[model samples]
Target: MAWMSLLVAGLLEVVWAFSMKQSAGFTRLGPTVVTLVAMLASVALLAWSMRVLPLGTAYTVWTGIGAVGAFAVGVIVLGEPLNPGRVVAAGLIVAGLVLMKLSSAG
Candidate 1:
């Protein structure tokens, strides 16, 4: 399913983003490789999903999922700051994503 592919692509986006941070500006070897691999897969799946989904919907949802997922990982794993404002922003992104999915014909 295109939507399923998009979801997986979004998750892969999170993986790549975290790994990219771990890569330390490509100074590290292992994390750099992981980042590159995940990035490729994420883009590939996103492109696949785009075959069926609207471009705006697919791109927006992909970025939204990645943004929220990376935010969670940053807070939980990296111990980044988690304030009320950031929480509300992430919630709003989720709200928009929900509305986008609901409005989609697919």
Candidate 2:
């Protein structure tokens, strides 16, 4: 449950981040409102997950998930280049997150 919440929060973080770009530095009203709401929701979910998950583990996972999701959005939606180095870096982030989870379980 906590893990699920964390994942949702992470995804929402990505949503809010993308929305922020559309918000035009908060000059755009609709996107700005959406960004604010999504950010608050993401933080709330993170707080909820923290009740059961270790702070370091949860935070790393949350940020990692957000980073990966945003990267994907940038590649797919924004047509950002997915170069070899970027792919390797993303893989490393995932690998680190996996290692953290495994070590925490043990």
- 52 in model 2: Cα distance from truth in Å? 0.7
The worst-scoring run of ten residues by lDDT in candidate 2 lies at 97-106
lDDT of 2 by residue, 28-94 (tens): 9999999999999999999999999999999999999989889999999999999999999999999
TM-score of 2: 0.94
Model 2 residue 41 distance off true place after TM-score fit, in angstroms? 0.6
Best candidate (score: TM-score): 1
Judged by whole-model lDDT over C-alpha atoms, candidate 1 comes out at: 0.97
20 Cα displacement, candidate 2 (Å) = 0.4
- Model 2 stretches astray by more than 4 angstroms: none
Deviating ranges (above 4 Å) for candidate 1: none
* TM-scores, one per candidate: 0.98, 0.94
What are the RMSDs of all candidates, in order? Answer: 0.5, 1.4
**Cα lDDT, model 2, residue 59:** 92
